[model samples]
Target: MEVKVTSSTILPSPTSHHSDIPLTIFDRFAANIHIYVIYAFTPPTPSNADLISALSKTLVYFPTLTANLSTDCHGRPCVSVGGPHEDRGALVVEATVLSKLEDHLPLTPSPDLRLLHPDAENPKHLLQVQLNRFQCGGLVIGLTSHHRVADGRSMCAFTIAWGKILRGVPIDPLPFYDQPWLKPRNPPLVQFDHWGSEFIHLSPQSNEFIITRTDVDPSEITNLLLHFSPDFITKLKAQTNKLSTDKHTTFETLLGYLWRKMTIARQLDDEECTTLSVSVNGRRRLQPTVPPEFFGNLVLNAYPKAKAKALIEGGAATAAGIVREGLRFIGEDYFQSFIDFGEVYGDRDLVPCFEKDGNVLSPKIEVDGWLGLGFDEVNFGGGGKLCAFLPTWVPFEGLLIFSPSLSQSGGVDVFVSLLEKHAVTMREISHSLD
Candidate 1:
């Protein structure tokens, strides 16, 4: 279907929060990428004008979203908020689609998908929105936010605030923006080996040297959403719990199960070690817990490695144990050490292996769990709720995102990107689980 942009406008932050803000180390290492989330609504959708008007007012409180990103004297990323005579505002595009909304139920990366988000490279605006209206009176709201400015939780907070404003409700308890809480310790200490097995320091002549990009045929890759019903999850949990004496949380259980299944689907060599990198939110994990509303990136990766044969042959409990063990490294001390490490090495061009392009260090999978982010509760206005939520596309192979199903059946929607042949095997494994 053809989509055309009719108008573009800027929505700047409120005049009150006009000031320059420096990014934390956590923010500096963020992928410097744009994350796109698409929300669909049926007929009787909220008016685009009304949504834009609400968004403009919402930006007043979230001025950082309207800010421009630049490097400081040390060449570290920081945001210039509300500069003099500058339009520090998010870009909003009004667009229309010729076809029905169902045509793109599960959004994927394409030239058309590119229209749903702001420019991925060199995002002129930290935040951008595209209001796409289909011929059937349905609407799809697309949001593209720079990862360096906020994490998924922060993005959800912004949406929640916007929804309240659209509904004429008071935005109680404003977001906390203090960055000192995560500052490095006085005498920076390198406690645990934070970059041990999971991260590889890139060096010339090193086998793990990084690549910015690689060419792969579009036809050779497949992106699909696999649904796991609540009942199925329960049954799987029962089966897994039978193998271990300790109980496993749903997140760990599901991740372990998926990791094993993906390993089998890939049909890798038995002796090869496969790693699963899970993003752990550091907001509460830190001592003197960070405020839930504190914006910016506050996440760290937890790497759990296992031999391919063990992962495929071991019960779900064994995989879950590895995942749980990986999480144990995310306590207060570990986070403090990580911050200190960043403080000392922030200017040394320390890039995470996962951030690079081309092949990962080895056969690996990365999962981001968004099951309880409460994005589904965001109501723009009227009674419309988000009917569907998913990223526009996967950035690389072996990346999987777990999102709560829109149906609210206590199930999950797994969005996965893998090679075409492996994707077929993954689909078969998903079906067998059912």
Candidate 2:
């Protein structure tokens, strides 16, 4: 891979807030995601200067796409609010010409991204690029994004825009990023009181994954939208209402089912405790329904407890009921009060970090409504429809994803990522469901 840094543009400091204060949603989460593409070009090699120049033009409209912290400030990315320094974030476009991609490069699917490097500690800025040449005349564009500002869907939108710019076309109706709907509570409704006792951040914990050698090949993890007919989903909902009325819980039921399956796959010892978690958005849980367009991260995790032996031996419906019960706790009042978690847990000296107790298996479940907004419609100059992926895995060894699928079925698609050895166990658990 031939790689060279051509432009290293940094944004100027913002006059908006003082250094000691915590950053606002836009200040903290606003950052660009870096994407690299390995393009396989034919004999007519594209000129590096021209390619960079065309790409730069795309940034003309999206001035915030590229940027880093300026010297005047403590390296925080510049904001778009005021002064000449405002909107100074510029993309660093580098063109690397490779003689042969295959012979010279590592063929692993994932790019080498340094996660905890000292210089790369910020949550907003990410390093990335596209190698125009490879051994087989192939190109590899690697993407890295700051998880703080944008989610996977937001990052992919930018990539599609870049592709269109490369093809020399106007991006139709530039992406709308207005996020007025996610306003913080006026008095700050929820307290962060119990966060310290109940939750664990990634700091100081060895939440590292011990990768075991496996013969299983990594493949494109596609979304499998489970089509539980409306009737089926309805039945589940009914079950949930009944369970909730009895104060048993429905979310817990689902989690129990999933937790059992995951544990059975791993064949954990009978005495082990298995943990499963889910995220609840605190937006509408307040006095008002959060605006649909609200975009910042307003999530909280829910961990339901269970013994591996119990989970592995439980019936499917029984497990689902456990998860359902757990979910009922996330009602409007819970969300409304949860807003205060910051205050509740702020004094406990909990810096953000991953949790790694190693004794339990915790699986996280998240269901966001971005699919309803038609993320597929995000197009730039018609290069094509955009496809997206969430690269970062939560701390849990087992992760279950529920997202909108491209099939337009209005059904949810699920993806599970676990250790390779658990394949047989997972298959058996899945078979039971079938």
Model 2 earns a TM-score of 0.55
Q: Model 1 clash tally?
A: 1
What local lDDT does model 1 show for residue 293? 82
lDDT by residue for model 2 (242-336), tens: 54444333333344555666677777788777655565555555456654334334454555556777766665555665665655566665554
CA-lDDT, candidates in order: 0.78, 0.43
What is the C-alpha lDDT profile of model 1 across 214-263, one tens digit per residue?
A: 54666566677888888988998898888898789888888888888888
In candidate 2, what residue range of length 10 has the lowest lDDT sum? 109-118
Per-residue lDDT of 266 in model 2: 70
Global lDDT of model 2 = 0.43
- Considering every candidate listed, which one attains the maximal TM-score? 1
Top candidate by lDDT: 1
For all predicted structures, in order, the TM-scores are: 0.91, 0.55
Candidate 1 whole-model C-alpha lDDT, 0 to 1: 0.78
Candidate 2 displacement at residue 198 in angstroms: 5.9
